[model samples]
Target: MKFEIIQPGSYAMIKATLTQGEAIKAESGAMVAMHPNLDVEGKVDGGMFGALKRAVLTGESLFFQTLKANRGAGEVFIAPAVPGDVTILELNGANHFFLQKQSFLASDDAIAIEAVSQGFFKGLLSGEGMFIQKATGKGSLAISSFGSIYKISLAPGQQYIVDNSHLVAWAGTVTYDVQKASSGWFSSVTSGEGLVCKVNGPGDVWFQSRNPGAFGSWIRQFIPSKG
Candidate 1:
């Protein structure tokens, strides 16, 4: 199978080309279009129990859409629910990724996506909740962002501070601590950056240019309130 990110940057989508009998699994409702030769089916990956775990833990869709080139080779277009950028991560057997809620778009059938615990304190303080989606195995995994996605590569022992809200995904090898953005709570709040993740990395980190929470807050003011 071959994957290409179409219309990169804001308003991005994925165009996947599959060989005969090849299949791709995507978040439910992500398929925008497909060739006539392609067949689509809804499936609960890893069964009902796995689906439940993914939905209840990470807020992902309970079902996945599997598109196959059953009839022959074909192309399928998959898109995210929001208008933003889309990119593909190539996961070898040795590497994995932890994706933010709803960042997953599509992946080759060889990849496995699971909901994993991030520990109690990190879960609560990291702003990604108790569980995040982990992608493993060998395949191409497509991830979406609320805005443009930028990648930061860190050398071993290098550290960087990132606002929690801007994170899209990070390499599993990276370690981070969630803490106040400033030395003091009052200064942190006043600085407009409350909690930030101090990332110690030997890997890459992907961040979205826009924060969904901040965007929501900005739009809320324009919405007429109930009198």
Candidate 2:
């Protein structure tokens, strides 16, 4: 299956095409447009949602969904139940809804919480932590990185260390610890643990390519360089 992210920033959308046997899950009214030959289904549950159950689609089911925040909710995350060719569309205004097939869980069991705000860098970091907790099964999620989106694998018996600045999202089942990276004596004296996030394996990790440091570098281009 192939995927393309159409918009990124406070609001994001992904446009994807599904070949035969591809599927994706969506909410009750999230479809902006879909293929003519695609089959659609509705979810019948309302339970606290994990990652996979959040989105759902059957084979070759063409559907589109939105992942924008509510009017006052600030930001929102759309985890459809079905997995397949998925596309994201940017919606206008604050209030928007879509039709989705709810067959996985009971409506009462579906997970619902106030949307998150992607306004600040720190807010994104916290969102990463929360997104992982909502992950289900062995599937890895592709999140938006500054330059591009990257994948994080959650393999057993292995550990991954990442800079907090670079982390986009992770699996909720994985445990994390704030550890210091060992630099030389002088380096260690000044930089402690380098502020790295040591993550246990059996889960995936996502990182952002461009960071605050990179942004600074880009902004510095206009400054006069002195030898």
* Model number with the top TM-score: 1
* Candidate 1 residue-wise lDDT, 93-146, digit = tens: 999999987799999987988999989998888777889899999989999999
Q: What is the C-alpha RMSD of each candidate to the true structure, in Å?
A: 1.0, 13.8
Deviating ranges (above 4 Å) for candidate 2: 1-13, 16-142, 183-185, 189-193, 217-227
Tens digit of lDDT per residue, candidate 2, span 1-227? 33354455433444445554554444455444555545545543323332233333211122223232222222222323332222222222322212112211111111231122223433334223222212122211233344433546778857887765556454444556654565455564476435566777676555555454556778899999798
Q: Model 1, 10: alpha-carbon shift in Å?
A: 0.8
Q: For candidate 2, what is the lDDT?
A: 0.39
**Count of backbone collisions in candidate 1:** 0
Best by lDDT: 1
